[model samples]
Target: MTGPVPENGQHHDLVARLVAVLRATGGTAAVCTACHAVIPTVDGVGLTLFTTHARFVLGATGPLIEQIEDLQISLDQGPCLHAVHHRAPVLVDDLTPTDPRWPAFASHARRRGVAAMFAFPVLLDDHPVAVLDLCRTTAGPLSDTDRRQATVYAAAAAVLLRADADADHGDGAVVSASAARTQQATGMVMHQAGIDAAAALHRLRTHAFDQNQDLAQVVTDVLTRRLRFDPTPG
Candidate 1:
C-alpha cells in the first residue's frame, strides 16, 4: 500500500485537495497560510460556515483573527501560537470555565461561543510557517481519523504558504513566519498583565510619539518580561 502523495503544482493545490477531503468528511476547518493569516481558499470558504454561524464577516473577521493572533504573540500563550512555534499540534477540548494556561483567551473564546479548538503547525525545515485549525461547538476531542487528516492538511498548507510568500516577494526572497508570531506574542503578554489592550496601544502610541522607538520594540519588551505594568501610580 502506498501512502497518499501530493500531486505536482505549488502547495496551494495540495491545500485545496486536503480541504476538499475535510469538507467531504463534514468537519469544520480553516487553513491559515503564511503566518496564520486566513487565506481565501476553497477549504477556507467551507470553514467560514463556523465563523458565519458565530457572526463573523469580512469587515469583522479580519480584525478578530488579527486579535487572536496578536493575543498569542503578545501573551506568549495560546494553542495556535505554541503549535506554530513548536511545529506541532495543540488541542483544547474545551474553552469554557477557563483554562489556567490561557485564562484570558479561554474566557474570551467561551464568550465568543468557541467550545473546542485544535491548532496544527505547518512547518518547513523545523520552522513553522503556517497553521491549520479546526473547531467544534461541543466539548469533545477530535477523533483519531480527524487528527490524522488535520496533520496531513497542515503539512500541505505550510508548503502552500511558502510558495505564496515566495511568489509575493519574487526572486527567491523569503520572510520569516516567526516574525509575525513574535509580534502576536508580544501583544498577548501585555494583555495578560491586566493592562487594557487599548491603553497599551495608547502607551505604544505615546512611545512612538515621544521617542523614536519602533512599536515592535515596545511590544517585544512587554512580551519578554522586560517591561512591567505598575498598578499603582508613583
Candidate 2:
C-alpha cells in the first residue's frame, strides 16, 4: 500500500461529502451506505457504538460488513473489537494464518472472502465512543491517501454518534418522546449549571435520583418549564 499524502482538496471534498450524509434523513444508516461510494478502496463499512454493557451496530453498508461486525461481537475478536478496546486503529493488510491478533475471526473472514481490514476508534474527550470498520476484498494495507481519508470519516462518525446519543435517537430513528425530552432537558441543565456536556448529563441523572423520579419525567418537567434549576439563591 503506497501513495502520496492526499492533497487538501481531496480531503476537503471527502469531508463535505460526509457532512452531506450526516445531514440527510437516514442518519447513521445513510452515512454507512454512502461512505463506501466515496472511498474507492473501502469495499464495506460497519459502525458500532460501545455501551457500558455491550457493543451494538448502529449501521452497516451491506451483508458482508453486517456479518463481520456480528461475528466480531459474538466471537469477541477481529479489528473492530481490538480497535475500540485499545482506543487505537487496527490495520491488517491480510487476514491469514499468521495474524495472531484474531486468528479465529480471521479464519471466518477469509471464508467470507474478506482479504483485509482497517478499524478506527472514534474518540471523544480521549474516550472511544465507537468503532468504524473498513473492509476490502483485496489483500493489502491502506495507502497513505486512504488512511488520511479514513481518519476524516472516523472523526465525522464521532460527531454523529455524540449527536445521536444527545438527541435520544438511534441513527436516524427517533428514540422515544420521553427520551427526546430528556435530550432537551439536558441542554437546559447545561445552560443553567454552566457546565460541559458530561456534567450536564450527570446533573440530569442526579436530579432524577434526588427527586425519586424517572429520568424522562424529570427531563420532561424541566423541558416544559414546570421545573427549573436555580442558578442563584432565591
Candidate 3:
C-alpha cells in the first residue's frame, strides 16, 4: 500500500534493468523473465492480464505458477483476482486452510505447496490492468525490501502493458478458451440450480474443491452432462 521509492541504490539499479527489459522485449513474458532473474526470494512469479471482455495469464516463471494462475481463473477467486478487484495489493503472509477469504484457493494452493502469496495490481490510467503474483514455498511475510521491489516490478509491468497496447499487440483482447467454457458452465449451473450467477459460480468452485478435481475438468463434466447441479449431485 505504501509506495516505496525505488531510488535506493540497489532498487534503482533494478528499476533500470526492468525498464531495459521492457524496452527490449515489450510484454509480460519479458517482465516475468526479468523478475525471475532478479528476485530469488520467491518460488515463482506470474502475470495475469484483465481486460474488459477477457482475463488470461500472460506469463509465469514456472509451471506451478502457471497452474496457480489457471486455478484462480477457473474459480474466479484468489489473491490475484482480489488485488485486481480492489486495485490494491493482496499479501497473504501464510496460506492456511482456515483462511476464509479464499477458501478453495487457499486449500488448493496449499496442496500444491504454496505457503505464501502476494499479488500486486498493475494499473494504467488509474484502472487495474493486470496482477503480478508472487508465490513462495515457505510460510512467512515478505521482507519490507522484497515488498517494495515487488511493487516496483508491478509498476514496470504496467508500463510494458501500456506499450503493448500502443502497438496494438491484441493481448488485451485475447480470451482463453478455458475461460469461455467456464462461463458457459457457470450459466448452465445457474439454470440448473435456480441460483444467480454469483451463487452458481461459488457452487461450481465448491464442487471442484470437494472432488479434488481441476476446475476445468469440472466445467467439462458440467457441459457434457456428466455432472449436474441438482440438489443431489449426479
lDDT of 1 by residue, 1-234 (tens): 123444545445656776565344322223433212333211111111001111111111233343444334344456766675566788777666468877876765566556777777667677755555555546767666556556666665455445545577421112233333333543564566456444545454345335544445565676677765554254
Among residues 3 or more apart in sequence or in different chains, the pairs in candidate 3 whose N, CA or C atoms overlap within 3 Å are none
Q: What are the lDDT figures for the candidates, one per model?
A: 0.48, 0.71, 0.78
- Candidate 2 per-residue lDDT, tens place, 20-139, comes to 666674555555656666677778887776766445566677767766775676567889989977898899888795568888888878887899999989887889877888998888
Candidate 1 vs. truth: CA RMSD?
12.5
Error of 2 at 87 (Å): 1.4
Candidate 2 regions with alpha-carbon error over 4 angstroms = 1-17, 170-234
Best of the two (1, 3) by lDDT: 3
In order, how many clashes per candidate? 11, 0, 0
Where does model 1 exceed 4 Å of error? 1-76, 170-234
Query: How do all the candidates rank in terms of lDDT, highest first?
Result: 3, 2, 1
Please provide TM-scores, in order, for all candidate models, with all chains considered together.
0.47, 0.65, 0.69
Give candidate 2's error at residue 233 in angstroms: 57
lDDT score, residue 129, model 3?
Answer: 93
